[model samples]
Target: MLVHTAWNDLPGSVRRAVVARTGPVRSVTPAGAGATCRLAATLQTGSGVVFVKGILVGDRLAWTLRNEIRVNPHLPGIAPRLLWHVEQDGWLVAGFEHVAGRHADLRPGSADLSAVAAVLAGLAAAPRPGLPVRPFAARWSGLIDSWHVAGSTLAHTDMSRRNWLIGDGGARLVDWATPAVGPAWLDTAFTVVRLVRYGHSPADAEGWAGQIPAFSAASGESLTRFAGALADMWQRQQDRAPAAHRGLLVDAARAWCRYRSGRSAVLMSG
Candidate 1:
């Protein structure tokens, strides 16, 4: 099997350092990835399983790993267990008990939607210790603004089904670098759009959005406004992305626009 590492294109020293720290590094298997390269590896020393996230070695990456560790602890059962860090190879190696399941295509009747929503609710309800209570409100408000700015909520900005891992009883969310403390709706909206873009029915997207209270609490801003602004931002982001990713973004933006516009009309009619 092909083992994927972030610095696989780099020198042996880098790979070696990661191997030495983790274990024998039996094989580097690409695990969950989309915009970033992720690898799952088995250690020769019986180290079990380890995930290596490639990052340019620096304070920024350091801050990211630190944030992962800090947030993981507070998230409890909601997040993956952060095992260890390997700084030498410019890879952040974390060991999590491998979850057994595949990515949900996010269909209307799919079981994955509820699992994903549950995780989102848990994340929205989680405490940030020193992080302010209204930590998500400000960014959400900005997104609501016509200016169309990204929110600061510790949201799993990339709530793609790709990041959600399904196991026996529940699903766990991975990838923490993009955490934003914005409106809870922002996160849910992103997921809902992703599902809709992937061909899930409008009702499914609405169903998922309806299940979350954090969506309302964190985004005291008008839901329609936030949805419209996010769709616009998503479009701009799509423009800058490579053609491949742009397609996904385009689909997602359309779904977002459709839902937001429909919601607005409904409110006016009521």
Candidate 2:
């Protein structure tokens, strides 16, 4: 588990570098360690509120911060703006336009579900930008075929509720620290798993995702294989870490895998 660095605990030079860009922080509320961020906080600055997230420059996963900076320009309304970045005293921090909003509700009958689907559809139709990012397959060890990273557009692999904020701008994604070059439809598929985790049945989750053109157009065989792969991966995660939250995902993944496997069997029989 990555420990969070308190805002006050940061070095004087590092804090100075951030304040220079944010314009004197009146109050700092620690945002906790996001995905791979070692330090995250929301600051009430003279100019406005800014969300800053960063990691130690010498940390093993510091590359994620670089990827966030590289991909920020490509995502417009779908993501918060990366106003600026600073590196000092072995720390790399990036300030983003703070978006005040609540985490999306993906439960059955939630209005946010449709909005989330719309966002995924728009992302799928977006033009692929040229960047030095690695393929999605590069992140996983032996899950290449399961990951299906051979598509043109980018993908936001992490689909947590907190990642999708519903605020003044409908929904805006945050923490693009580990985006990948893969099938845009894959992103929607990930959301389907989240929907199931949030109380939607496998069929309902699929139906909800089917509204998005990408998910609707995805190959059925690929979806089945992806479901099975996710179940196996999550099961392994549960065994290794035994985290309570991950255990919940393990159940969700297995449920989807069973549903998809049954669908595949029905299709073959017909």
Candidate 3:
């Protein structure tokens, strides 16, 4: 587990690094969420308040912070603006525009579903960033048909509810650390799995994801293949390291696969 750094306890060198860009810090409010970053807080600077997230310089996940900084500019309005970044002493910190909002409620029939769909649509429409990220389809290459693994869109592969913030402007996607290049509909499919974990039936989750034009336009066969690939992957992950959350994800993935298979059979019979 990552060790968290309290805002007031940050090293003086690190504080100076932040001060050089944002001016003197008036106050600091530590953020108590997210697993990847140990040092995250809202810094009240002389200019304004900004959300800053960081990790120890030697942490293996420090690369995630760099990745977030690299992708933020490419995301446009879909994510919070990356104001600045600092790598000093023994920490890597990046400041972002502070967005005040609540985590989206993705349960079936929640109004946040519409906002989530809109964000996914925006992600689908976004132009691919120039960075050379791995193609998402390659991750499941031989497990699924080759045709299912096509498209150049940037996908925010992780779509858990905690990553979404529902502000006055609808849903804003955060945590660009795990972005991938993949089919336009992939994120929506991932969202479907998460929706099932959040109490939606597999069918209901599929229906909710279908609200987005990109997902709606995808081939059912491709989606079924993708679902099976996800189920297999999650099952292996659970086997490798059993965790309560991973177990839930495994169940959700299988539920989605079964839903897709049943729907395919119904369509063929009809």
Candidate 4:
């Protein structure tokens, strides 16, 4: 997890720059330890509420936030609008419209499933705006071709519970901190693991994934390879690091891989 910076920790000049865009800063609330930016917060401002994400100019991770800014402009209505951005006091910050919502519940039988599906469907249909977005890692090249990843427009490669929010309007995906160029079906694939993690059986989770046309069209061979490749990639990490274990997704991938091989019919929640 990233060591987050509180809103108050922002340099005075940086805060002033943000205020100029937001009117007056009344309260600042950090959005927890989000994956990329150094600062992520919701601020109560004189004009209204604005969510902000930022990074120090010299931080090695600044590229992540920069990609976020580039991609935000072309995002669909399901994403929060980027209101403004500022660079001051060696900090770079971007302000967004503060949307109100609760985290999506992806567990079995939850009403939020369709809502989450809608967001992914729309995201798949969205036109790829021109940007310097990178391709999916070369390590999974076989998964790439089988899934037709090269045919993708734009994808929010990271799909976690926290990245999805359910508001009165339905579901909206957030945290484009690390976007990628991959098959439209890839996000749906990422989501299958989430469904399995939450309680859905592999068959049931895949049944849910099948509702998305892209995933539905995926060949069984491709789906099998996708699962195996995803599992293997992180397993290698655990092998080398012996410590840095972000293995929940890996475990989910393994379970699905096993089921695809006709190995079992159970939801193995590790």
The prediction achieving the highest lDDT against the true structure is: 3
Q: What is the lDDT of residue 145 in candidate 1?
A: 55
In order of listing, the candidates' clash counts read 12, 0, 0, 0
TM-score of each: 0.75, 0.94, 0.93, 0.88
Model 4 residue runs over 4 Å out of place are 137-148, 238-245, 263-270
Q: What's the true lDDT of residue 204 in model 3?
A: 81
By summed lDDT, the worst window of 10 consecutive residues in model 4 runs over 261-270
Best by TM-score: 2
RMSD of each: 4.6, 1.7, 1.8, 4.5
Per-residue lDDT of model 1, residues 30-147, tens digit only = 5434343334443333477655554445434445545665566555676667766655555555555455666765766677778888887777666544453234444456555533
Return the lDDT, model 1, position 70: 57
State the C-alpha lDDT per candidate: 0.61, 0.86, 0.88, 0.79
The lowest-lDDT stretch of 10 consecutive residues in candidate 3 is 234-243
**What local lDDT score does residue 200 receive in model 3, on the 0 to 100 scale?**
93
lDDT of 3 by residue, 205-231 (tens): 888787788899999999999999988
Q: Stretches of candidate 3 above 4 Å error?
A: 141-143, 239-242
- Indicate the TM-score of model 1: 0.75
